[model samples]
Target: MSTQTPTVRGDAYLIVDDHALIREGIVRVFSDTRPQARLFEACNLQQAIQTLQGEHGPSIDTVLLDLNLPDSRGLETLQRIKAVAPDIVVGVVSGTDDDHLAMQCLQQGAAAFVPKHGELDQFVQGISAMACGGIYFPRELLWQVTGRLSAADAPPMVPGVASVRLTQRQGEVLRLLLKGLSNQVISNELGISPETVKLHVSALLRAHKVSSRVHLILACASPHAA
Candidate 1:
């Protein structure tokens, strides 16, 4: 059976990578399949931020971000980008084969992870997957990062006092909170008021027995907690 190609909108894409060839290759692929996909190029994080913040007002539907850049390193780059544009769908493109880093990127709101060493087919597939509302993680790396599990596998939540338990709404807030989304972003994402997001955040902190959002994220990502 033939696979369906994603129809990316004409004016929504940003590519942030230091290497010229990689950027060119990505542009070529998109140009071939998604001729309507408008492309913006950035050699570094600062430039990427400028492109996003430029009078267009977050028109970017997807971003292909390189983890290693002259100005930023490791996960810090991802964090900075997300901080600037929490609503933009980000995909981490990296040279390293670090599965753990890829998993962390996913946890931090990246829509996909693509390795530089992977085949062009895989990269194209990843982009298509992201464009179609699916996350793309390398098949080989998934088990190493998320750990092996069967269909029946389920992790237990921590037992605690009833007051400390999170309500369904509060739990949704906590999920976004763990992604380091701000109150305004969370409010918009959840379709709730900023004040309500703030209240839910406060409630989440109290329930998780944590004093700060950083602590809450650490708690939520902890293996023991899940």
Candidate 2:
């Protein structure tokens, strides 16, 4: 466990899980760390979507979603949530600790992927990191996910990173992307169109030799990467 207490942002958060106990536990975790944060709950995907679409939706800045809800399962749950609320920061909490699944969730716009493996501290820290405008995943699992990419196909390493240059706009896009912001959010922040953001993202992927945003993030975090 970290010796220093993480600084959690006071943002409105939503917990989406069918299990009442699970939802309450997560709420308690957040409350312990961020007592000022406004929190809400939903038992399934439909309720979650409705909550996001509700009048109070605009105030919601973050969400902790369970993949095994009664109405939704696997990556589909995440997909639906992102489709409705692209700008909201989502942290996926699942019983399965599959690194590939975590990667998929990140590719699909999740800010964090935390496995519900009985580590309350890890969950709290992950949510804290995301709340503070950063991405989070278990370090071991993240390395494992990066290891799946072979050297030949991996993104540019720190040694050769100088060779891969990016435009000013692409650099701006990459910075926001690393913060787990969606294309729309980045576009808004940078005063660019979403289509323009997509072009810059494509350019960034090519420059980094990465296929997806998740891969790009992991590559940048790797010790061997720039």
Candidate 3:
């Protein structure tokens, strides 16, 4: 297994992929963006786990996981890591162009789903967003999911928020929220006043019983969500 040992220190991002080139490229991008950031490398799931269990383990907050590792594949690998360290922020790095699979990974608790072949900015954005407790739904996947959910004919709400049902307008507002749009932007898009948009958002938050917009987004974007 190939590995690069960095003595610089800051946030810890463990790149778990079987390919040395893939892991190295990601490390380069990270080093350029945050020079002081310490990056760890693992060629497979087992090595990845060992890296996490080592001395600097607790300091590690972000994990960049490749779905097609030698020891595992698909969302199962993500599930295993989360099972071991629920606190770790895992952002999936997939070569697959499957939106459904990417969405599934997000639902399975990945903080972000980055297409391996996508722009370098997107990969950085995914890791950066996840590091800050934000979900980085890839632009391609986001556009698709937003278009799909904009129809407002979604499935039933999941168990925890089963009682919360968003009206059509509320659903639109929710979709905008997931897109990270500001109230003014949403209002402009919906051709409604900002106050009206705020009203709907407040109602949605109350119905979902979330104290903040972030929680609301997480609840809705979850796999078991409405």
Candidate 4:
């Protein structure tokens, strides 16, 4: 068999999950679609931390975070990673279909939210959109959040929000980032390359005029807060 060469790109990504199979599957997908994308793997939070905190740490552009790891659990997992690296984009993944909890994550700081059972195409679309300066959210959840806002009540522009005009996809990515998923997870869940996720994140930062992911999360989560 012929050997496959890795793609070279400006972006780099990390995958943090406990399952070897899942990690392998994700790597394969990225390798196939984004040959230039570089991928890193961590079996647990500690390993993830080591890779992220190393001398070459700045090269990482995005992360794929799992909620249930051997060393971390629940939202704490997301919180800790954000604390460690505020600039890197993150996407959250879980086995259960818990939209409310997922929304809570968005409110906190995840780039995207995806269920394990979601269709592969939807997942890929979500990741691709996020990579291309867009966002992705579950259709049901998007409706749930925006359904209460009347068209008249909705402004031509969201008040006091002049920096970034959120494309639907960017909004989706912002929502999930607030929720705390890592870039690799977002890529796998959305079936896209991690580098794409990084592109959207950079666009988001520029649009928001925010210096870091922490500020982006705060702005998105506390729209009413002064």
For each candidate, what is the lDDT? 0.68, 0.73, 0.71, 0.65
Order candidates by lDDT, high to low. Answer: 2, 3, 1, 4
Whichever of 1 and 2 has more TM-score, that candidate is 2
Error of 2 at 6 (Å): 28
User: Per-residue lDDT of 170-220 in model 3, one digit per residue for the tens?
Assistant: 777778777655687688899999999989888877887776555665565
Report the C-alpha lDDT of model 1 over 1-226, residue by residue, as the tens digit: 0122333333467889999998888887777757766677899988888877775434577889998899998899999999998877788988865767766887787767878785778777666654444456665554432232211233322223333554567766755554444677678888999999889888777777877654454455456543
TM-score of each: 0.59, 0.64, 0.64, 0.62
Off by more than 4 A, model 1: 1-11, 143-226
- Mark the 10 consecutive residues where model 4 has the least summed lDDT: 1-10
lDDT of 4 at 36: 69
Number of colliding residue pairs in model 4: 39
**lDDT for position 27 in model 3:** 76
On TM-score, the stronger of 3 and 4 is: 3
Which candidate would rank higher by lDDT, 3 or 4?
3
Which is superior by lDDT, 1 or 3?
A: 3
Residue pairs with clashing backbones, model 2 = none
Candidate 2 worst ten-residue window by lDDT:
1-10
lDDT of 4: 0.65
lDDT of 3: 0.71
